[model samples]
Target: MFELLKQPWHWAVSGTLIGLIVPLLLILGNKKFGISSSFRHICASCFPGNVKFFKYEWKKEIWNLFFVGGIIIGAFIATVFLTDPANSIRIAPDTAGILNSYGITDFSSLMPVQLFNWSNLFSIKGLVFFVIGGFLVGFGTRYAGGCTSGHSIMGLANLQKASLIATLFFMAGGFFSTNILIPLIFKYLQ
Candidate 1:
C-alpha cells in the first residue's frame, strides 16, 4: 500500500476523482466547487471592513474556508510523508533543453534553486516571475470570476457558457506564456 502510494497515479485515476467532486458537492449541499472565492471569505472574516464587496454574509460560505484548509493540510501531508527522497522530479528533454539555455541546469527539486532562492527573489527575473506574475494572476483570477480549477472543472460540469470562454482564454494564455513570454523574460531579465 505504501509503495503504491509512493508511485505517481495515472491522470485517468486523478481525473475521475476530480470529476466526482462536482456531483458530490452538489448532492451534499449544492455547494459550488471553487478555490479563488476562499481568499475573499478569509479577508471578509478577518478584516470585517466597510468595503461593499466584502460586506456580504461570508459565514454562509464557511465551508469554502474549510475546503481550502483541507487542501493546505493535504499538501503538507503529501510533502512530508508521501515524498520519496530517492525519486527526483523528471523534466522532459525539450523542457530540460530550454531551461539549460536559461542557465537553469539544476533539476534536483520541484523548483530549481537558481530561480527560486532568496538572492534571485530580489533580482530582475525573480521580480518578474514572483511579484509581477503574482499580481497578474490575482487580477486575472478576479477578472475571470474564478480560477482554472473552478472554470475548467465545476463550471464546465455545470455547462456554464462563461466558464467555457474563461477556460479557453486560460489555455491560450498559458500557451502564450510558455512559448513567448517566458523566453522573453529569460532573455531580457536573466
Candidate 2:
C-alpha cells in the first residue's frame, strides 16, 4: 500500500479527482468556490471590520471553512498516517550532483521525504521558512482573490477569463521559480 501510494500514477489519480471537483461544484447551484474566498470569508467573520475593502456580512456560518479545514486535515493524514510513496519524483543523478555542488547535499532531507520525520517539521530553519511562506501564501491568496485550486478549477470551470489569465501567470511564475530561482539560491547556500 505504501509503495503504491508513491507512484506518479497516484498523483495522476489525485489530479483527476481534483479535476472532478469544479464540475461537481457547478452542478450544485454554483457555489462561489475558491480557497481565497474562503480565507476572506473567515477573516471577515473574525474581524467584522468597517473598512471599505473589508466590508462584508461575515457573520454567516462559513461551511467553506469547514471544507477547507477538511482538505488540510486530509492532506496531513495522507502524508503522515497513510502508507504511501509520497509522490516523490527523483532528480537525475547529474542534476542532483549539480544541486550538491550548491550546498543541498541531501536535498530531499529538507522535506518529509518519507513522511515520518515529524521533528523536521519544527527544525529552526524549517520553522522560519514555514512561517514566512505561510504568511506570504496567506497574503497572496487574499491579494489574488483566490488560490491556485480555486482559480484554476472553480473559476476556470465557470469560464472566467480572469481565472484563465491568472492560472497562466501562475504556471509562468512556477516555471521561473523552479528553473531559475531555485538554482540561484542553491548556489548561494553553498
Best by lDDT: 1
Query: Which residue runs does candidate 2 get wrong by more than 4 Å?
Result: 1-8, 27-29, 48-50, 85-99, 105-128
**TM-score of structure candidate 1:** 0.91
Residues 1-190 of candidate 2 have per-residue lDDT tens digits of 7665544455578788888877676677566666666767766767757766557665553767876898899978866755344445566799778756654555453253432345646664344346655677788767776778778887787788988988898788779866897676546533
Lowest lDDT 10-residue stretch of candidate 2: 108-117
On a 0 to 100 scale, what is the lDDT of residue 56 in model 2? 61
Residue 40 of model 1 has an lDDT of 79
Q: Name the candidate that leads on TM-score.
A: 1
**Candidate 2 clash pair list:** 6-85
Stretch of 10 with least lDDT, candidate 1: 2-11
- Local distance difference test values of all predictions, in order: 0.87, 0.67
lDDT of 2 at 60: 56
TM-score of each: 0.91, 0.69
Judge candidate 2 against the unseen true structure and give its global Cα lDDT, from 0 to 1: 0.67
